[model samples]
Target: MLGVVPSSRAPNPFFWLEDTHTNTMEAIAMTIGHSTIPRMRVPALLKGNMIDVDLASLEGQWGMLCCLPRLEFCDAVFLNQFRRAVQKQGAALLGIQHPAHPFLAAHLPKAKILSIPLLTDSAQRIGRALGLSSETHLNQCQSFIFDPEGVVRNKLTHSFNWHCMTLLLGILKQCQ
Candidate 1:
C-alpha cells in the first residue's frame, strides 16, 4: 500500500503518495511541481459578459484556476466559498469547463452571477497544456495555484473533495 508524504520544502505544501517503483507517477509529480502555466487564448464569461482573453495576461497576480467536469448548484456553492477564500488572500479564482458540458450551460445564469471568471475551454487547449486531458476524463476536476510570476506553485488533482479543499486553502495561505 502506498502512503502519502509531504515534501520537506517549506511553503510548498504539495504531497505525493510514495511509490518508488512507479516511474510514471514520479515523472508526473515532477512535471506538475515544476511546470508553469502555458499561454493561451480562450473564451470566458466574466461579470455576465463573454470575452476572449489571453491566459498569460493573468500574470502579476496570484491566481487559482479550477478545472471541473461540470458545474452544479452544489459546486457553485463550493466555488463561492473558494472565491471568498481566494479573494481574501488577494488572489483571483477562475473556473474552467468544456463548453460542451451541459451542466455548465444549465448553470450559466448562476455562474454569471458569481464574481469569479468562468472559462469555456472549447478546444481543450488549456486542459491539454496542463496535462489534465484524457480520452476518458477530458474534463477531470483539478485545481492549480499560480504565483504572481505565473509559476505553478501547487496543484490538486481529482479535487473538489473536502480534503482537497482544505489542502488548497492551506496552500493558498502559504503562497500568499
Candidate 2:
C-alpha cells in the first residue's frame, strides 16, 4: 500500500503497510503479537459504567479479533498496544479467552486486571468458530481483521510484527 499524501503533502487518511522508509509515530506505535485477545460481548462491565460492545455496536466497526488463553491477557504491553490500535481504528478491540478467567478492567489500580471472554456459539453442528477443537491449540493469539461489514479483510495467523500491523493499518485505511 502506498501512502496517499495530497498535493499539499499533508498526511492523508491512509497509511502504507509496506513502506518501511517513512516510519511515523502511528506506525511505530502499532503492535503485532500473540497476546490473548479477550473476546468480549458488547456492553460489558467496567468500573461502574455500562460498556455495551457487542456485535450490534461492533457491526460497523473494523474489529481485530484476538484469541488468548487465561492469565495471558493481562500483559501490560499487549493490553496497551491492543487498546491503542483499536482506538485508532475506531473499531472494537475484541478478545476471546477461555471461560473462568478474570475480567478486563478499563483501568485497574495495580493488580486488578481481567480477561475478555469469548462468546460461545451453540451451533456446534455447523462448525468450529474459534478454529480450535482440541484443548492444545498451537496458534493461540491469531489476529483477524474484519471490515465494517463484518467480513474478514486481513488475517495475521502466526505472529504480530511491524509488517503485520502495517498490513492491518493499510487495510484499515482502505476501509476508511
Candidate 3:
C-alpha cells in the first residue's frame, strides 16, 4: 500500500514552508503557476457592504490574495494603511480567514476589517488548494499578487514586514 501524508498533518513551525520555497519576489514575472482562478464567487465584506468577487471575471486587472489567521489581529489602522497602499497601485486586495460565516456574523458589526474585501474559507478548501495551509493554521502572512493576465507576478509567504511590504508595493507599481 502506498501511504500518503495527509495535508492536515502539522508542519514544523520552526520552518517557514512558503518563505523557503523560492525567492520569486525579485525574479521576473513568469507563468509557471498556471492554474486559473477558482470558480467560486465568495462574498467580500467591505465596511458593512457585501460584494461578490467573481474570480472568473477578474481577467484584466492586478489583484492580491491574502490569508490571515484571524480578523481580530487586523486593526483599523493597519487596514487603512494597507488599503491605501493597494489603492495607490490600482490593485485589488482580498483576504480570507477561517469560519467565514461566524467571523462575519460576529465581528462584521464592529467594522474593524472593512478596508479590504475578505472571503471566508470555512472548510479550508481555498487554503489547502492554494498551498497556504499549515499544521496549525493557514499561512497568516502569506500573500500572492497576480498580473492582468492572471499570471503570478510576485509571491510573498513568509513573515511580513515594512521592507517586504515596500517590495510588494514596488512590484504592484511595476505591474501598473
Scored by lDDT, the top model is: 1
Report the lDDT of model 3 for residue 4. Answer: 22
- Residue-wise lDDT of candidate 1 within 27-102, one digit each (tens)? 1122245667778777776656776778889889998887776666666777787788778888888888643564
lDDT of 3 by residue, 97-162 (tens): 544325465345445446777776666666665655453343236667777777665555544444
| TM-score for candidate 2 | 0.48
The numbered model that scores best in TM-score is 1
The global Cα lDDT (0 to 1) of model 1 is 0.66
Residue 41 accuracy (lDDT) in model 2: 47
Candidate 2, residue 128: how far the Cα is off, in Å = 2.6
- Local accuracy of candidate 2 as per-residue lDDT tens digits, 4-64: 3333332433232334366532221122323322233444433323355555456666776
Would you list the rank order by lDDT, best first? Answer: 1, 3, 2
Cα lDDT, model 2, residue 109:
40
Put the candidates in TM-score order, highest first: 1, 3, 2
Cα lDDT listed for each candidate: 0.66, 0.45, 0.58
Instruction: List TM-scores for all candidates, in order.
Output: 0.69, 0.48, 0.64
Q: Answer with 1 or 3, whichever has the higher TM-score.
A: 1
